[model samples]
Target: MTSTQETTRPRDIGGSPGHWRRMRMWATAHAVDDFYQGLVPAAVPYFVLERHFGYVEASGLALAATLGGALPQVPIGLLADRHRLRWMSPLGISLAGIGAGLSGLVPAYPLVFALLLTAGVGIAMFHPPAGRDARRAAGGSATAMSYFAAGGSVGFFVGPALATPALDTLGIGATALFIPPAVLMGLVLLRHHDRTPGATAEKVRRHGTDQPGRFAALTSVEIVRSTISTGVNTFISLYWIRHLGAGSGLGGTALTLELGGGVLGTLLGGRLADRIGMVRTVQLGNAAMLPALWLMLACDDKYAALPLALLVGLISNIPFAVLIKLGQDYLPSRPGTAAGVTLGLAMSAGGLFMPLLGVVAGHYGPRGALTVLATVPVIAILLSTALREPVHEPEPPRATPSTTHDRHR
Candidate 1:
């Protein structure tokens, strides 16, 4: 592997129409998988309204989902690395959908929490294997990975856009309506996996020496970024409705715009990383976040704040896909583990702080919670300083047939 290998076209994976088709399928499945994750936050405000839950209680739901999603990922990653787990993709998505769909159907808070937790576990199960396959399909191209990452961003965007109207109309029970996409997408993925030759036993061989120090630093940066992202996602609607005196519709609109910007930002970051280098892209994104947060905080007018929300989201996520790809670069032998931590644990770990932010929101309102969030980017910027470009030693020429067969055996 070399820099050229990292930046080149997907020719390594044969660059066939079939390869790209697989990439598209995985990306679509990513969107469907993540939609449930996004739905938790979208439905949180309604949970507050209908159940009359306190801020801390509302945040607890987030914590349930976060904890379930974050804790088991590393082991799952290890399993994905050692075996072909094509079944996990569809099974995980179906579980995710089932859990999220049932969450709002019940009246008890404990049951709601448990359902969301189940949904989170499904999310945990989906990422490692899905990410491993997506990376293989991408042929190590950051831009290609961004397309996959952008799928999650799109899912997050669509969650609020669709959930808001439905919740507004049918109330919370509308969450049940979201179940079908996940099931249908899961079936599609299952059918594809079964039809594709060698899909179940394709091996991902170990490569290059691992760089734990750099990967640790990268994970730290991502943890901070995730905290900020989760805080905003969990609170932005409430911020608009309570502090800015906006209606629920506008509050939901603000969230939708922010997540929509995230979709664009993920795509832009991928392209930018291909040109400027991943570390620089990470630093640049973190640096841009300061002013974006400040401007968003300063806006007194709700409508005017909407664009700033978009800017905030765009700047905040510019490093997201880059971080995920760079993590795999840093630990080349463990792409599954890299994706697990970056895509699952580090990403969801931020939700662990939601209860604390809820306390802040309870004390001084959503603005105060957001004000606390403004400090996170500075920390992310400092952490980005510790990241270095990973060196990829060139791979040996193709092995002989007997060598390949023996290795496979």
Candidate 2:
């Protein structure tokens, strides 16, 4: 090809040219999309207060949101893998925000359920394709992927902070305020997504070997960890309110410390993964969980629980990004499918067990519910020991001027 002709063709969707910039774009979109998810739980209290939803009814809302997102993800991931649909990211993120943001405006229980379901579907839509793209940009760097994961952590932290005041002063109708960020971020992602690159056919083929045993084990580990984490998130505030006689402000403060610890844990896990390898990092997180849980339980003082909450959050979340990356590596031929299970099914499936925990809490109290969480990490630690890191060839060097045209062809 002539020099000008070669220059005119867009760069192939392979290799790590401007990788960091591309990852940041995907991460920013991730943060925006997940912010809506974080809003659902935070809005539960308002629903009970304003809409007069009973415990069962309010829990149903959370269930609807979870089912909507979790059920559709596998099919969406399959479709994304087959089509590599570039438009999914923008459309998914926007739909997610709109559906979630509209929840407060609806009066009837049925309408609120429908809106939150749509939001969940939108969240599911964004994850598979966005994860695929982010992996391409990250070039197998667990640390970089952690930074991307950290964006979601930050968004979850920000969601309640933004939503509480709006709902407090303006009432449920103020949910409309959340819509603009979704629109803005969707437009921003739409502008750059097509320009972003994806994995080459060769790279995908090289690591295409499937390991079903390892995948199943990894998934089981996630289920255990997710179950424990979700239980803590659901009951930790109540623990403070009931056991410690803490006021509303202190309850919120406890949750904040937990989430803030997650942010720190994510960053730390990624760095450790890169240094000690993925399996060991997973092991480290699992091992730490028991002690953290013990510390939180032993502390009776509200002020003492605050710091333990941070420790528990860090231990629980440290393996998150590493697990996602490991799942992808294990099923390289089916990264989208892997993302569907790891990010969608495995994580949200844990929430399904909450009703059972509620049963436990009812009979034994929230402290008993939390006490059950302590044993889950032991299962995870044993499972982590069995995980073997998937192997692949080293990344090839980027094509230089002397070989650019040849490699492009």
Candidate 3:
């Protein structure tokens, strides 16, 4: 291949060269930061069982963390884009971990709420800038972004596992045990933040315009996907245990299978996006999810439901990384804004919809809720089909020799 052709070729499916080193550093910190996000839910059962908090109070605590973590994301994204806040990721990760860790020591309910809120803020702060940087290093390859996402997925699973054991043995205060990884990671990320190539080059463009229509369309699709995902996460265990008469171990196993499918989906989605167009892969994923969800819901046996849930999870998450990349692509000028809306805000918003599903479950049972959730992907599919990929304005064609010669003649 000619040197020029090689230079202009898109990055490999693996990633741009040297991306792994930075991907590892950023992704590792992401895992640590996201661990706190995941830990919040695990701690909820502890509050209910040990603190003697009622369901409403427990949910309020969760609400505090959710609001704090998810709400500030857009403003944070704006800040990262506007100010090039290089230290935000390190600071955010540290505070997120520290807040969650210290929550155990705070005896009062109000104090615990405050601590969780602080941790949520930290988690929120880390994501926008971290994702923006990861994109820069990704060099247009969605596969690289998948690695970043997979790190968080691993951390999410690890958080619950780690929390369950420690909180079981040491009580809720055992949350403090999780602090070291965050602090160490924060320091490491902070010290090396600027070492990567062209750290400032990806800054938000002052005069660059965004495709607002495309961005809006993309966000709508994400909301549907996120709502379905939240529903599955919230009720899949219950469906297994109560509905299918599965034992607690099997219920947990079902949840694990689903989440594990998501991790695998995140990695493979990026590869699929690289091979097929991002839009097509995303559509295919949502299309596959419709049947998977139905199959999971239809399965009468516990074992049958288990693999189906895994399939549902895999199909549901197949667009995860691609959607993030597409959001940024659609709003290239406001990448942080795109990332925050798509990755952070939309997800939290989906949690808000979970109540509606609960209401359905209350009236018609979990099967009814699953039925509604299955239909959510159809909205995603429609949106994906209607939306057009963002098209960069082409540069005026360079003058050809014939044209130049004609002009001279």
Which candidate achieves the best TM-score against the true structure?
Answer: 3
Please report, in order, the local distance difference test score of every candidate based on alpha carbons.
0.83, 0.82, 0.81
- Expressed as tens digits, the lDDT of each residue in 92-129 for candidate 3 is 99999999999887878899899999999998999888
Query: Which tens-of-lDDT digit does each residue in 155-180 have in candidate 1?
Result: 86777667878999998899999999
In candidate 1, list every pair of residues with a backbone clash. 1-395
Q: Flag the better candidate by TM-score, 1 or 2.
A: 2
Candidate 3 to truth, TM: 0.91
Q: What are the models' TM-scores?
A: 0.88, 0.90, 0.91
Q: Name the better of 1 and 3 by TM-score.
A: 3
Best by lDDT: 1
| Error at 276, model 2, angstroms | 0.3
* Lowest lDDT block of 10, candidate 3: 2-11
Candidate 2 local Cα displacement, residue 203, angstroms: 4.0
Candidate 2 runs further than 4 Å off = 1-22, 198-202, 394-409
A best-first ranking of the candidates according to their TM-score comes to 3, 2, 1
lDDT of 3: 0.81
